[model samples]
Target: MRYSPNHKLETKEKLLESSSVSAKKSGFATVGVDGLMKAIGLSGGAFYSHFSSKDELFAAIVERELCQSLARLGGHGEQDCARLERCLKHYLSMAHVEQPESGCALPALGAEIARSDILVRQQAEIWICRLQESWARILDSDSLAWAILSQCIGALVVARMLATADIQRTVLQSSQEEIGRQIAGRQQAICK
Candidate 1:
């Protein structure tokens, strides 16, 4: 039997939601059609009704995952610097880096995206744009926000790659303090 439009849309949304977390935790390439469908009480054959192919699904889910991270990190704010600080602190904390499944996609799936297909790359750019815009919102300058995002992402990626918790914490704390100072200095200069 054919499903209604609403049903089809709902299925697609569920598929994206389930697959987003799975892809984030297990890398997009590894999340099989069978497993993904099974997670949402559907079968492999039904996937095509929602997505044309695995790459399409990956693209959709990646966009969603990045958007979620951006939102979590306070993507938009008028002047609540404290909220932005809290989000950054949480982002770079040892807990965030230690858990790939529950952390930002930048550190968790950066390498995968770098090596992924064009569709995924395009989605990655959208994510990058979101982050850049989010940072600009906090710093009030497009360049400064992009710079801070780059530094934070780079530091988190390197820190997560380290073999020991101590090194990871060191990287986290050090980057956090340095970035914090930079942001404060920028804001102070503006105030002065």
Candidate 2:
């Protein structure tokens, strides 16, 4: 059977997409190479054809996920404070909390990213910083941007750790409220 030249690139793209979802839904370390390949309807050995090693695949996933996160939370250009507010609301909602697989990769895979090699972590940091910068530009305070970003990610982590939906909702609501206050206060301070 003959395959188009794009077939290899297309297969790698599919593998990355499937593996990323699996890694975020579960832990990256928990899912083996064979499992990742199987998720994309490929054999374990075929994984080597796409990636030199599992670590390489992980690096790719980090880049892909973070790029997505940047696009979602970070406005393309000329974003306003209102857009940032809407983003914070959506990011801290129950839907995001319940859907780890489809949600932000940071809260889902932060621990794994922390444990990975320097290269992977460096890639994550770049995207994270871009997100922070986007928020900072809109908020007009770098520290405020960092605080809200950390709180949002931490809120998701804490909310997911709990067993009950009500308590999870409480955590998310409190964080959002506090963040809203912070933003409002910043605006008031600017007016004063």
The model with the greatest TM-score is 2
For candidate 1, lDDT tens digit of each residue in 1-192? 987869988998988878877776778788789999999999999999888898888778778778888778755566466777778888888777767677788777788888889879988898789777877777777887877787778888888779999988898888889888988988997798
lDDT of 2 at 22: 88
Provide the TM-score for each candidate, comma-separated.
Answer: 0.86, 0.97
By summed lDDT, the worst window of 10 consecutive residues in model 1 runs over: 74-83
> After superposing candidate 2, which stretches have Cα over 4 Å from the reference?
none
Clash counts per candidate, in order, are 0, 0
| Residue-level lDDT for 11 in candidate 1 | 90
lDDT per residue as tens, model 2, 57-172:
99999999999999999997788777788888999989998888898999999999999999999999999999999998888899999999999999999999999999999999
Q: How close is candidate 1 to the true structure, as a TM-score?
A: 0.86
Give RMSD to native, each candidate.
2.4, 0.9
Off by over 4 Å in 1: 1-6
